[model samples]
Structures are given as structure tokens and as C-alpha cells.
Target chain A: DVKVTQSSRYLVKRTGEKVFLECVQDMDHENMFWYRQDPGLGLRLIYFSYDVKMKEKGDIPEGYSVSREKKERFSLILESASTNQTSMYLCASSLWILAGGPGEQYFGPGTRLTVT
Target chain B: SQELEQSPQSLIVQEGKNLTINCTSSKTLYGLYWYKQKYGEGLIFLMMLQKGGEEKSHEKITAKLDEKKQQSSLHITASQPSHAGIYLCGADKGYGNKLVFGAGTILRVKS
Candidate 1:
């Protein structure tokens, strides 16, 4: 079974604070992603890394940045957190392909950040 | 931009009843994925359908992709309280790797 783990389940921070959320996958997958889930708006992609040291912006990546210094770990960074950034953060990882097709993503439990 | 629309934003069903959730896309789908998410938890993958007119089942949960590959339905038979959660459908964003998800349908099962 594949397992994805996040560094924190919940966190609270004041506005303008720098926040870091970490994710680690045990399956040695080559692709990792970060997303934020909000009520009504659904999950919006923040960033995705296809390989170590490689990153790409998704639909919504203005306030967020990502780091993939190693294969097993991916980190989401909020250079300066704002109250509007408070939401559930999700991390997912998957192989480039499975059975010659697009692979299914395995997600971590998530980190619920509260920016006050 | 690609978008996925899920119908019946929320549903309430009684135990032993059957219910279905639909996901529709404006463009052809390369792949469709079904996932269930408990409150405050990550998404649990339920099924994946790639080919049009394909159907797959897991226990009492069944998912079908339309012939046009632009729509999919997830049906649950003999519903149980454990089935209550948010159902989200994801579509391959044509980039061959990224995914775009629907707003999600929330299901509440009463015993």
C-alpha cells in the first residue's frame, strides 16, 4: 500500500507569517502536488513537482511556492500567510504512469491551516 | 481551461437506499477518477475509468463512464452510514499528468 504523510494536522498562525507544510510519500513516486480546499470553491491546485528540483504553477499559485529538494519530500511554502489563505491543504503523489495510463493519486491526511 | 461539473451539490439518503452522483465535463476526458473524502480527512480513491463506456465496481459502489467520455456516474447500492462523505471526480487536464477536480458532492447517509 502507498502512504502519504503530512507534517502537521492543524496549525494556527498570525497574518503575514511564513508557513511551511511538509509532505512525504513512501511509494517513491515521481509526481507530487499541493492543493487548498475551501468550502464551495473546492480544491485548487497550488503547485506540482514532476521531479526533484522541478516545479510548475497550477491554476492558482500566486501566494504559494514549492520545494522538492528530494524525491520523497515536497514542501509547500507560504512566503507570507494571509487570513484568506486559511484552509485545508492537501498533498498527493503518484507515478508518472500506471499500466501505460495516467496514474491515480494518493493523498495525505492534510494540514488544516488557520491564518488569523 | 478545463472544468468539471458535479450534479446534486449535496444529497441525503437513508440506509439501504440507492443513490447516484454524476460528473460531467465540457471536453473529452482522458481519465476519470472517483474519490471519497471523510470530513477533515484526505481523499480515498474509489475507482478510475479511462475508456469510454467502461464500468467498474468495488463492493456496492459502481462507477460508469459514458460513451462520449465526457460524463461519469457513481452509483452506490445498499447504502450504509459509512458511505457518507464528500464525493469528488477528477479529470485529466490534457497535460498528460495534472488533474482538475469538481467542486464535489456531499452525501449524508442516515441510519
Candidate 2:
């Protein structure tokens, strides 16, 4: 079975502080993505890395950036944390395909960030 | 921009009852996917439909993509307590590898 792990389950940060949320996948998949889940707004894409050192901005990438220094590791960074940035951050990884396969997305437990 | 909208923001069902969640797309759905997430958990891929008028079944869940390829439905038959969770519908327009998700439907099942 594929396993995706996130660095923290919960974190609290002050306003204007820089935040880092890490995710790792054991399957060595080619695609890694970050999304934020908010009530009523759903899961909005933040950023994604299709390969090492290659990143693309998803629909919602205003205050977030990502890094893929290695195949198994993807990190989500918040340049300046704000109260609005606090939400459940999800990490997902998939193989190299636009259309996913059966049980396509392998996700991490998620990091619940709280900015005060 | 591509958008997927899910209806019935929240639902309450009894055990052994049937429930359905709908997903509507603003643009053509190159690929539609269904996922489930327990509170405070990760999203679990349930099913995917690629072609128009396609339908697939798994256990008690059945997902169908309309012929227009712009909408889809996920039906849960004989709902159980374990079925209570947030159901999300996502779409990939074949433009990029990233997926766009809908505002999930929160289902609460009572025995």
C-alpha cells in the first residue's frame, strides 16, 4: 500500500510568521500536490510539484509556495502566515497521469494549521 | 477556470437508507473523481469516471458520469454508520495534472 505522511498534524503560528508544512510519499510517485480545506469553500489547490525542482501554481497560490528537493519529499511553505491561512492543509501524490487510476490519490493525514 | 460544484452541503440519513450526492461542472469534465474523507483525515479516492455516460460500482457505492460529461452522481445504497463522512467530487480538465475539487457534502448516518 502507498503511504503519504505529513510532518505535523497540528501547528499554531502567529500572524506574519513563516510556516512550513512537509509531506512525504513512500510510492515515489511523480506528482505531489498541496491543497487547503476550508468550510464551505472546499479543497482548493495551492501548489504542486510534478517533478523534482519543478512546481506549478494551482488555482489558489497567493500566499503559498512549494518545494520538491527529492522525489519522496514535498514541502509547502507560507511566506507570511495570516489568520485566513489557517486551515486543514492536505498533501496528495499521484502517478504521472492527468486522469487518475483506481484509488489514484494517496494522501497524508494532513496538517491543521492555526494562525493567531 | 474550471469549477466543480456539489449540492446538499450536508445530509442526514438513516442506516440501510439510500443517499445520492450530485456534482456539477462549470466546464466539461475531462475526468471526474470521487473521494471520501473522515473528519480531520485525508481524502480517500473512491472512484473515477473518464468517459461520458460511464458508470462504475464498488461495494455499496455507484458513481455515474452523465452523457454530457458535465455532471456526475455518487449513490450510496444501504448506508451504514461507517458511511458518514465528507464526500468530495473533483475534476481534471486534461489541462494540467492538478485536480479541482468541490465543496464536499457532509453526510451523517444514524442507526
Candidate 3:
């Protein structure tokens, strides 16, 4: 079984504070992603990394950045947290491709961030 | 850009009942995935369908991809309280690893 773990399960921060969410996977997957889930809006991609030092912006990447210094770890950074940034953050990891098809993503338990 | 639309934004069903959720895509889907998320929790993958006219089942849940590969349905039989959660459909955004997801359908099972 694949295991994805997040650094924090819940966090609280004041406005304009810097925040970091970390994710680590034991499967040695090559792809990792960060997403934010909000009520009614669903889960939206924030950023993704395909390899070490490689990153790409998703549909909603504003105010957020990501780091992939190593294969097993991915970090999401908020330049300056705002109240509107309060939401559940999820991290996922997957193999680039396995057996001629895309691999299914395994997700961590998620971190619920509250910005006040 | 590809978009996925999930029908019946929410559903309420009695235990032992059967229900189905549909996911339609604006463009042909190279890969479609079904996931269930408990409230305030991360998503758990249910199934993945790639071929046009393909179906896969796990326990009491079954998922099928339409012939055109633009639509998919998830059906659950003998529903239980444990089945209550948010169901989401995701598709590859033409890129192998990138995905676009639907708004999700909320399910509430009544005993």
C-alpha cells in the first residue's frame, strides 16, 4: 500500500503570515500535487511537481508556490496567508505511468488551514 | 481545457437503496477517475476507467464509461451510512499527470 503523509493536520495563522504545508510519499512516485478544497467550489489544483526542481502552475496558483527539492517531499508555500486562504489542503502522489497507463493518485489525510 | 460536470449536485438515499451519479465531460476523456471524500478529509480513489465502454466494480460500487468516452456513471447498490460522502470525477487535462475535477456530488445516506 502507498502512504502519503502531511506535516500538519490542522493549522491556524494570522493574516499576512507565511505558511507552509508539507507532504511526503513513500512510494517513490514521480508526480506530486497540491489542491485546496472549499465548500461549493470543490477541489482546485494549486500546483504540481513532476520531478525534483520542476513545478507547474495549475488553474489557481495565485498567492501560492511549491517546492520539490527531493523526490519524496513536496511543499506548498503561501507567500502571505489571507483569511480567504483558509481551507482544506490536500496532497497527492502518483507514478508518472505504470504498465502503459497513468497511475492512480494516492492522497494524504489533508490539512485544514484557518487564517484569521 | 477540459471540464467535468457532475449531475445532481447532491443526493439523499435510504439504506439498502440504490443510486447512481453521472459525470459528463466537455471533451473526450483519456482517463476518468472516481473518488470519494469524507467530510473534512482527503479523497480516496474508487475506480478508473480509460477505454470507451469500460466498466469496473469494487464491492457494491460500479463505474462505467460511455461509448464515446465523454461520460461516466457511478452506481452504488445496497447503500449504507458508510457510503455518505462527496463524490468527485476527474479527467486528464490532455496532459498525462494534470487533472481537472468536477465540483462534486454530495451524498447523504439515511438509515
Candidate 4:
């Protein structure tokens, strides 16, 4: 079975503090994604990586960045966190076939971040 | 541009009753996926539909995608207590890293 594990489940940070969220997948998948889920906004993609050192910006990518130094690990970085950034962060991984085919993105337990 | 929209933010029904959730999109969807998210947990994928006017079923649940490619429905036959959760519908143009999700439908099935 494919397993996607996150570094933390609950995190509390002060305003302007830097934070990092880590995600690792053992399925050897080629695509990794980061999304922040809000009540009414649903799940909005923050960043995604297809290969090592390759990253793409999603719809909401402000004040956040991602690093994909290895094939199995992806890290999301918040240079300066704010209260408005408090939300549930989810990491997902999926296998990329030859073309843009339908793939199930498996998600982790998610990390609930609270900034005060 | 808000690609997906789900109706009936919340619903409550008795066990054994049937329920349907709707998802509408502003743009044509190349694919649609249904997922269930429990409280304070991750999402579990239920089904995916690619072709328009297509229907798929699993156990007591059935999903249908309209031919117009703008709307989809998830029908649960004889709702059970275990089926209670936030049902989220998502769509994408092709199958890349990007997907837009709906706000989700919160369902509570009473026993």
C-alpha cells in the first residue's frame, strides 16, 4: 500500500516566525503536492513538484515556497508566517504515467497550523 | 475562476434513506473525483469519472457525470452511519498537478 507521512500533525507558531512542513512518500511517485484547506475555500493548491528540483506555483502561492531536493521528499517553507496563514495543510503524492492520465493523489493526515 | 461548486453545505438523514450530492463546475471538466474526509483527517478517494454521461458504482454508492461536463452527482443508497463525512468533489482540465475542489458537502446519517 502507498503511504504518505507528514512531519507534524499539529503546529503552533508565532507571527513572523518561519515554519517548515515536511512530507515523504514511499510509493516512488513522481508528483508531490501541497495544499491548504479552508472551510469555505475548499482545498487550494499551494505548490507542486514533478521532479527533483522542479517546482510549479499553484493558484495560491503567496508567502510560501516549496523544496524538492529528493524524489521521495517534499518540503513546504513559510518564510514569514502570519495569523491569516493558519489552516490545515495537506501533502499528497501521485504517480505520473506516460501522459496526463487519471491518478489518485494520496493524502497524509494533514497538519493543522495555528499562528498567533 | 471557481471551477467547482457543491450544493447543500450540510444535510442530515436517517439511516437507510437515500441521498444525493451535486457538484457543478464553471468550466468543462476533463475529470472528476469524489473523496470523503472525516473530521480532522485526510481524504479517502471514492471514485473518478472521465467521460461525460458516465456512471460508476461502489457498494451502495453511485456517481454520475452529466454529458454537459459541468455537473456531477453522488447518490448513496441506504445511507449508513459510516457514510457520514464531508464529501468533496474535485475536477481538473487534464490530469496534472492542479485540481480545483468544491467546498464539500457535510452529511450526517443517523442510526
Candidate 5:
């Protein structure tokens, strides 16, 4: 079975503070994604990495950045955490099979971040 | 407008009842996925449908992709309390492995 683990399940930070959310996958997938889920708004993509050091912005990438220094690890960074940034952050990883299309994404338990 | 739309934002059903949830897309879907998420938890993949007129079942849950490939439905038979959760449908956006998801359908099973 595939396993995706997050560094933290819950976090609290003050306004203007820097925050980091980490995700690691054991399946050696090539694609990693970061998403924020909100009520009524649903899950909106924040950023994604296709390969090491290669990143792409999604629909909502403002106020957030991502790092993929290694294949198993992906990190989400908040430049300056604000109250509006508080959300349930989720990380997912998938394999890119050119012949068969992208595989299903496996998601971590998610981290609920609270900005005060 | 939303690219993917899910009907009946929420549903309340009694145990042993049957219910169906629908997902419609404005564009043709290359791949459609069904997932269930418990409150404050991550999504658990239920099924994936790729071809038109495809149907897959797991236990009491069945999912079908219409012949047009623009719509899908999930039906649960003999629903139980364990079935209560948020159901979300997602589809590929045609590039970069990006997926667009619906707002989700909240299910509450009354025992």
C-alpha cells in the first residue's frame, strides 16, 4: 500500500510568521501537489512539482511557495502567514505514466493550520 | 462557473436506504475519480472511471460513467452510518496531471 505522511497534523502561528508544511511519500511518485480545502470553495490547488527543483503554480498560488529538493519530500512554505491563510492543507503524490496516463494521487492525512 | 458540479450539496438518509450522487462536467472527462473524506481527514479514493459507459463497484457502492463521458453517478445501497462523509468527484484538466474537483456532497446517515 502507498503511504503519504505529513510533518504535522495541526499547527498554530501568529500573523506574519513563517510556516512550513512537509509531506513525504514512500511510493516514489514523480508528481507532488499542495492543496488548500475550504468550505464552499472546495479543494484549490496551490502548487505542484513534477520533478526535483521543478515547480508550477496552480489556480491559487499567491502567498505560498513549495520546495522539492528530493523525490520523496515536498514542502509548502508560507512567506508571511496571515489569518486568511488558515486552512486545511493537503499533499498528494502520483506517478506520471506516459503510456498509461497519470496514476491516482495518494493523499496525506492533511495539516490544519491556524493563523492568529 | 465551476468546471465540475456535484448535485444535492448535502443529503440526509436513513440506514438501509439507497441514495445516488451525480457529478457533471462541462467538458469531456479523460478520467474521473470518486473519493470519500471523513470530517477533518484526508480523502480516501473509492473508484476511478476512464472509459465511457464504465461502471465499477466496491461492496455496496457502485459508480458509473455515462456514455457521453461528461457525467458520472455514485450509488450506495443499504447505506449505513459508516457511509456518512463528504463525497467529492474529480477529473483531469487535460494537462500537467492537474485535477479539478467539485465542491463535494455532504452525506449524513441517520441511524
Candidate 6:
């Protein structure tokens, strides 16, 4: 079984505060992703990493950044948190066969962040 | 730009009833995925459809992809309260398997 775990389930921070959300996968997968899910907007990708120290910006990567220092872990960083950034954060992992193929993503339990 | 649109933003059905949710894409889909997310929880993968005119079923839930590969439908027969959740359809536009998702359909099954 594939398991993806997030560092926090619920978090609250004030404006201008820096936030870090961590994710770890035990499936030895080569791809990790971060997404922000909001009502009526669905899940928008924030960042994705295919290898250690390699990252790519997704559709909505303006206020967020990512770090993948190791194969099993990926971290999402908020340089300066704001109220509008308050949303559900999700982390997912998948195995990358060759360059790009149909791989099912395994998701974490998600972290609900409240920026006040 | 490619977009995945799901219809009937929300649905409330009685237990034992049958309901269907639709997802249509603006462009051709390389791969389609269906997931279920409960309130305040993570998404649970339900099914994935790649080939056109493909249909897959798990227990009482069935998902079908059209021959055009631009539309998909999820049908749940004899729905139960346990099936209440938000159903999201995602499409892969042949870019490193990155997915674009729909706004989602919220299903509320009342017993």
C-alpha cells in the first residue's frame, strides 16, 4: 500500500507569518505534488517535483514555493502568508515511469490552513 | 486552454436512489481520473479511464468515458449514506501526468 503523510492536519497563522507544510511518501515514488483546494475552484497545482532538487511551477504558483531535498519528502513553503492563502493544502505522490505516463496519485490526508 | 467542467454542482438524493454525475472537457483527454473526497479529508482515488469508450465499475459505482475522450460520467446505483462526498473529475493533458480538475460535484445521500 502507498502511504502519503502530511506534517499537519490543521494550522492557523497570522498575516505575514511564514508557513511550512511537509509531505512524505513511503512508496519510493519519483514524483511529488502540492496543490491548494478551494471550493468552486477545485484543486489547483502549486508545485511538482520529479527528482531531488528539481521542481516545476504549476498553474497557481504565485504565492508558494516548494523544496524537495530528498526522494521521499517534499515541502511547500509560504514566504509570507496572507488571508487569501487560507485553504486546504494537499500533497500527492506518484511513480514516474519513463518521462510521462498515466500514474495514479496517492494523496495525503491534507492540511487545512487558516490564515488570519 | 483546456478545462474540465462538471455539471450539477451539488446533488441531494435519497438512499437507495440512483444518480449520475457528468464531466466534460474542452479538449481531448489523455487520461481521466475520478476521486471522492469527504468533508475535511483527502481525496480517495476511485477510477481512471484512458481509452475511449471505456467503462469501469467498482461495486455499485460505474464510470464511463465517451468515444470522443472528451466526456465522462459516473453513476452510482443504490446509493447509500456512506457514498456521500464530493466527486471530482480530473484530466491529464499529456503533460508529465499533471492533472487539471473540475469544480467537483457534491453528493449528499440522505437515509
- Return whichever of 4 and 6 wins on TM-score: 6
True contacts kept of each: 0.58, 0.66, 0.52, 0.60, 0.36, 0.62
State how far residue B66 of model 4 sits from its true place (Å): 1.2
List candidate 4 segments past 4 Å from native.
Answer: A98-100
Looking at candidate 2, what is the lDDT of residue B109?
99
Q: Estimate the TM-score of every prediction.
A: 0.97, 0.95, 0.96, 0.96, 0.97, 0.98
Ordered by DockQ, highest first, the candidates read 6, 1, 4, 5, 3, 2
Clashing pairs in 3: none
Model 2 residue B111 distance off true place after TM-score fit, in angstroms: 1.3
State the lDDT of candidate 2 residue by residue for B54-73, as single tens digits: 99999999999999999999
For model 5, residues B6-94, the per-residue Cα lDDT tens digits are: 98899999999999999999998889999999999999999999999999999999999999999999999999999999999999887
What is the C-alpha lDDT profile of model 4 across B1-111, one tens digit per residue? 647889989899999999999999988877899999998889999999989899999999999999998899999999999999999998864656456789999999999
| Weakest ten-residue segment in model 5 chain B by summed lDDT | B1-10
Q: Residue A31 error for model 3, in Å? A: 0.5
Residues A35-65 of candidate 3: C-alpha lDDT, one tens digit per residue: 9998777789999898999998988999999
Residue A53 error, candidate 6, Å? 0.3
| DockQ (CA atoms), all models | 0.71, 0.59, 0.65, 0.67, 0.66, 0.75
The lDDT per prediction is: 0.94, 0.91, 0.93, 0.91, 0.93, 0.94
Q: Give, for candidate 2 chain A, the lowest lDDT window spanning 10 residues.
A: A96-105
lDDT of 3 at A2: 80
lDDT-wise, the better of 5 and 6 is 6
Query: In model 6, where do residues sit more than 4 Å from their true spots?
Result: none
Docking class of 5: medium
Ten contiguous residues with the weakest lDDT in model 5 chain A: A96-105
Q: Which of candidates 3 and 6 is the stronger one according to DockQ?
A: 6
TM-score of 3: 0.96
The digit string of per-residue lDDT tens for model 5 on A1-116 reads 88999999999999999999999999989999999999987789999899999999998999999999999999999999999999999999999766544578899999999999
RMSD of 1: 1.2
